[model samples]
Target: MVVNVSNLSPRLRQLGLVAVLFGAIPAGLALMGGGYPFQVGITALIFVTLAVSLNLVTGTAGLLSLGHAGFFGVGAYAAALAATKLHWPFLLTLPLAGIVAAALGVIVALPTMRLISIYFAVATLGVGEMIHVSLLNWVSFTRGPMGIRSIPPIEILGLDLSGVIGGYYVAATVAALAIFAVHRLTHSYYGNALRSLREDDQCSAAMGLNPVRLKIEAFAVSCAIAGMAGAVYAHTASFISPDSFRFEESILILAMIVVGGLGSLPGAVIGAVLLIVLPEVLRGIGDFRMIAVGVFMFLSILFLPKGLLGEASAIGLARRQLGAAWRGDIGAGWK
Candidate 1:
């Protein structure tokens, strides 16, 4: 009577996961009467997208960036400005936000590419602070600390999706697509090149891989995806402030990947969901909710040093689920 999920083929497993994400979970939330739960769901989905994007650069490419939230804020502000000032629609604003963030990412990458280890990390930290300060001080442009207000919600062709249920679906769809894209990129030879860079840039360069170019591309792509998540946040929340995307936010995101196990796509998603949902679930604990979260994080680090799902296990699972496609059983090469 019990189905063995592990025995399912890669395609089947993927379909089941999609069903759970896009179908069962939403249906359950709907049964619970939506409301605040939907808000949490949307927030979790947004963080999921952010975590996956961060995983690409920090986990896969081995670049410890501390300014991810700055890029996220850039995306939100870009989308907000485009929507409020330019009167652009959601469709246009989404891509615009991503493009703007990606452009900034490239600029940051160019100067910081040569820096490595903690030096690069500090550089990103400074850049993130600069972004926060700029947003706080640019009163004329970003409306200073007042933040953007009355931003339109997700509406495609006049269908208003600002309601709880509708917004959850929109967020879920975006998160799903982001996961799919990251999964594809990470499982391919391209991902292999990134891992090479992570292992040793010098050796990778000697192997003819352009470490600088690859890192830049990875960073740009990661930022672009983070920007898209920001667009979703802006539209869904209908408001945003510089305070929302500060250094703490970036650290929270970094913690998600670290807790989930770096270099693992599945781990990133799991970590995002856990960090977002666990605190909410512990809300009954009054002021100690965050303390509980800290304890859980500490225990996780102590017992599960490699993470709840380590990279090695995650890769093995991926290979098993992917089956022929992963092993090139058909001789079509690594697809």
Candidate 2:
């Protein structure tokens, strides 16, 4: 039976539509003779989590952070420390990583919350660099540039994930949870406060909203989600280090949110997948791969404007457009 879409609330419609399509992709891929297709699909989930988390600041709070990689690193390292050294359960370590990142976020936000726009981005850049340098110099914590390898895989009820397929499920579940949480938050009164602040801080404050608390809360929550994604990544890659969560990583997440139509969750996912996995699709181009990516990204920013999905949505308005055309439709478009 065809699932009903096109009339639900924006968030509900988006989430349900995604759920329906996601369940079918694996079976279709299998029917088409693809192996372990869910693995790539799962990676998209993890990346989406990172992007949406970044969306909180860039989208809702109107704060541009150039150093989100710092929080992502914090989460991965925390998970590494807990699972490998402390011998904690994988389940136990997952939330702990988020907590660690949240704590760090609070500390960083307290100092930088007063800044905005370019100054805010610059301040976060410094904070991110400090995190990266700390990971390198504080060998005892991060194990230095060598990074923490041999990360333990997730074990659910004592069943260890033996392949990428299982990883897809785990990543998808985490990503779904993050999506729901973000959706709930965005619809809440606090989310309204954030949007108000994003539009105009002085007006938001004049109405008696505490920009500092709201900004700090948004930063803290965003960092926590980044940390959660990082922890998931550590397990998926079975490794960790300062190098993996560098400035580029932060920029990639920022691009995901920015290009995906800013404050939209579905936009975040679409942007992440295009930026993260599409690179693999271009890898066969050899030396031109990076160049193609640059060009594609440039074109996406120029032509797509909001993002690939955003552009696709604009093209999807015609009743004659179905299937292939729909695939080209970027529903992530807003405004």
List the lowest-lDDT window of 10 residues for candidate 2. Answer: 317-326
Give per-model CA RMSD. 1.6, 6.3
Error of 2 at 225 (Å): 0.5
lDDT of 1 by residue, 1-335 (tens): 99998877778888999899889998887787779888999999999999999999999999998989999999999999999999899999999989999999999999999999789999999998999999999999999999999998888889888797888888888899998888878887888899999999999999999999999999999999999999999999989999999999999899898899999989999999999999998999889998988898889888888888999898787777767776765422254
C-alpha lDDT values of all predictions? 0.91, 0.79
Off by over 4 Å in 2: 1-4, 7-18, 28-39, 308-335
The TM-scores of all predictions, comma-separated, are 0.97, 0.86
| Cα displacement (Å) at residue 274, model 2 | 1.0
91: Cα error in model 2, Å: 1.2
